[model samples]
Target: MKYKWKPVLAAMLASFCLFSSPLTALATDNTVSTIEDEMVHNTEGAAEAGSAETQTGESETPVQADEEPGWPSGPSIVAESGIVMEVSTGTILYSKNMHAQYYPASITKIMTALLAMENCELDEQVTVPHEAVYMEDKGSHIALDEGEVLSVEDCLYGMMLASANDAAYALAIHIGGTIEKFAEMMNERARELGCEDSNFVNPHGLPDERHVSSAYDMALITREALKHEIFRTVSKTVYYEIQPTDKQPDLIPMSNHHKMICSGKYHYDGVFAGKTGYTVVAKNTLVTCAARNDMELICVTMKTEGRQVYVDTATLFDFCFDNFKKVDIGSSGTEGEEIEVSVKEGDSPEKTEKIPFRISEDGYVVLPSQAEFSDLKPLLLLNADRGPEVTGAVLEYLLGTRTVGQAVIALPESMIVKPEPETVQNETESEPEQEKEKEGKGFRWWYIPLGILGALAAAGAGFLIVRRQIWKYRWRKNRKRRRSGRH
Candidate 1:
C-alpha cells in the first residue's frame, strides 16, 4: 500500500571518524584530499544536474560488492557493516552486519548537525572556546583560534563539510554550555531516534572507546537527521567560504569530504545531501543520497574493501530504483461484503441478525519478488453477551505480515440488547411451593379487582356499539315518515 509519509525519513545511515589507524584509512584517501580539485573539474556537468550526479564514473556507488556479480546476488553488501535504503521511504533495501558496532568517526557530526539545528538558532553567534580550539590531540580540526566568534550557521558548515573537530566542539559548547552536556544531548537524540546500539562521548566523533555506534544505528541517526531541511542543505554542500570575523581576516574555505557530491559516476539525479566517515577501524565508510524519477535512496557502507564500497553502494541503489515500485496497497472506498452476525434477545426471535462490512481498494505493495503477503488477522470487535460491551469493531489491514494500515468495520448499534427484568430473573432459582403460595396471596387479591375493571371496560364498549345501531335505525324511520307525509 502506498503510505503518504508526513515529510519524514527514518534514521538509517550515519558514521564517525575517530583518529584510529583503521578509522582514519577511509577518510585520508584521495577522495578526501582532492575533493576541491574534483569539484572544479566536474563543476560544469554537475551544475547542469544540480549536485545530483557526482564526477565522472563515480555516480551511485554501492556500499559493498555481492558474493557473485550480474545481479544483487546476496544480502546487502557488508565489509564490517553496511545498509542500502530507499531515501523517500526510509526502507532498508539491503543490509549486512548492519548492527555491528564500529566507531562513527566524523559521521557522528551528522548528529551534531542535527542537534545544532534543533537546539540553536542558525543566527545565533557563538564564541569559539579555548577547549574547542585546543582539541589538536584529536585528528580533525578547523584550527579556529580561541575567542573567535562565528555564527552557528558557519560552524555547521565547518562541522559537516570540513569534518572539523573544533567546529563541532565549539557548536556543542555554545549550544549546551559544555561538550559533555552536548554529548548527552546527542546520545538522548540517538535513543529517541531508535538508534539502539549507539552511544556518544564527544560531538566531534574523535577516538574514544566510549564513542561507538553500529551501522544500523548510524543509518537510523542519518535517517532522522535528513528530515531537517537545514541538515540536508549543509551536508550536501561541496564548498562554502566562511566570512571573515573580527579576529580572523581570511575567509575559511569549508569543503564536503564525501566524494559522491562531486564524483560523476555515483551522483544520483536527486540526492540532496549525505555524510561520510573513515577510521582505520571503520574503514572507508560512506552514506550517500541519490534520486531517480523522483525516488530518492540513501546507501551506507562501512569497512569496505578498497574502492568497491562506493561501487557496491551504487549497485544497491540501482537495483532498488529499478526493481521494486511504490504502490497503493489500500482498500476501495465502497463497502465490500456485509457479513451477517447473530444478535441475541432480538424483538423477533427469527430476526436475530446484524450486518458488519469490510471495504477494500485495489492496490499492490512494493516489495522484492521474494517477498510474500503476510497473514490477515480479523480485528473483529463484535459486541458479545460476555464482558464489557465491544463498542467499536474494526479490521486493520496487513502488509507483509505487519499491520501497515487499518479498515474500520461498523457494528450495528441497535442490534445490541439491554438486559430486561425477565432476563435477570432467569438467572436466579425460583422458590418452592410455600413461596409460591406466598406469591399467590398477593396476586389472588389483586386479580379479582383487575378482572372486574376489564369486564366493565368491555361492557361499556358493547353499549356504545348498540347505541350506534339504534341511532341508524331511527334515522331511517324518520326518512320513511317524511316520505309518507309528502305523499
Candidate 2:
C-alpha cells in the first residue's frame, strides 16, 4: 500500500513545485563596470569611491610640456636637507636634499623612547646603569646617579621632553641588554622602516662620525615611532617632573626644548610633537610632526641655523596643508564587483585570460588643490614588478615623480581565468560521421507539416461529399413533386 501511494504523492508534490512562485534569491542586474569594478571589494573595505578619471595604465587627462602642472615648490629656508612627508600615505610633499646624511642630534632619542615603550610595560621600572651616571654628559642630562631607578613611562617622558642622553642610554641598556647591542637594534629597526642610509653606534645623538642619518631616514623612523601610544604622548609633552627616586632626593623638572610645542615665538597652530637637536658639527637639526584637516605631516630639517629650522618646518607645513588634498583611486563604483583586464592567453594570441582585481579604497594620493583626479598617474605592478613596499599593494599612485599612495589590490588565485583546452578531431577518422551529418541535413522533418496538411485536406473533402449527397436528395424530391402535379 505504501509503495503504490508513493508515486501518486511524488507526482502531486512535483506539480505543486512546478506551479509555485520562483525563489527571490536569483535576482541580478546587468550594468557595465569600470576598472574599479573589475576588482572585488575585500572585507577590509579596500576600494576607491569612483575614479573614472583614469585610463588602463595612466591618468585620464593628457599632460604636455607647457600644460603639465608640477608639484609645488615649498617656501625656501636655510635648511640644507629638509622634507615634508604625509604620515598616512608616506607622500613626500616638499623635499630638498632629503637624502643627504646629517647628524640627527638629540632627535635620535625618538627611536630609544619608541623601543622602550615596545619592549617594556609603562609601569616597568628601568635601572640606571653605572655608565649613565658618569658617562660623557656634556650634552643634555637629567643627572641620574648610579643605581637610580625610573619607570619606562618616566624615562620616555624625560628622554623626549628633556632630550636627556642618560635616560636614553639607560632605557637602551635595559631593553637591549647593552648600549652597543641597543645601537645594533636601532640600526635593525631603521632598516625595517626602509631607512637605507642610516647607522647608529650610540643611543644618544652625540657627535659620532659613524652615527649619522638622513632627513628621509629620520622622517621614516618618526613615522614608525608615532605608531606607539607612549611615543605619541611623550613627543608632544611640553613639561614633566621626575619625582624623588630611591637614589636621588630632589625633584627633577624637565621642559621640552622644541620651540613649537613649548609655545615659543615660533609656535604654529597644529604643531603637536617635535624634537630639537644641535651640535657644533651637526649645526641644528629638527623633527616635527603636525596635524591639520585630517592629515598628519612630519617635517624633518637637518643642518639648519638656530631659529631657521622652526621657520623652515612651519613654512613647509603651511605650504603642504594649504596646497594639497588627498584623493581616492580605484574607489567604489559598485562594491564587491571586480573589473577585469584581459591581457594575454598562455602561449597563443588567439585566446585571452582575464585576471580579476580591485583597487584598495585605503589607497589615496595627495594632490594639489587645483589639480584634478585625472592628473594623477596609476602604475599597476603585477607579479615580478611588486616590491617590498608594494607587497600587498597592486597599484602605486604618483603625483609627478613622488609616490602619493598605493592601492590594495586583491588578486585571488581562484578567480584567474584560464583558457579551456581544445579537443581536435582528425578529418580522416571522422569521415563516416561527416557523411552521416551531410545525409542527416538532407533528411528534413517534412512529414510532420505534410501530414498536418493532408489531414486538413481529407476533412474538407469529406464535408464536400456530404453536402453534395444532401443536395442530390433535395433535387430528386423536388422532381417527384413536379411529376405528381403533372399527373
Q: In lDDT terms, which candidate is top?
A: 2
- Model 1, 307-404: lDDT tens digits are 44556666667777776554333433225455443332324342334365543323233444444333323333343454355444444433334332
Q: Cα miss at 32, model 2 (Å)? A: 71
Give the Å shift of residue 174 in candidate 2: 0.7
Instruction: Report the lDDT tens digits of candidate 2 across residue range 1-487.
Output: 4569888999999987776634322221111111100111111122132222221213332221112348665665567788888988898887777787888877788778767767889999889998887874336678887889999898888788777778888888899998889999999888888998888988878778998999899999999888886687888888799999667898999877777877656788888787877665786789999999878899998875456566667778888899998766655352355543333223434322344556544666777888876555555444433432233335566567667777766655653333333323454558889899999878568988999999999999999999999999999999999999999
| Reference-based lDDT, residue 197, model 2 | 80
Best by TM-score: 2
- Decoy 2 TM-score against native: 0.65
Quote the positional error of residue 239 for candidate 1 in Å.
Answer: 1.9
- Shift in Å, residue 377, candidate 2: 2.5
> How accurate locally, in lDDT, is each candidate?
0.64, 0.72
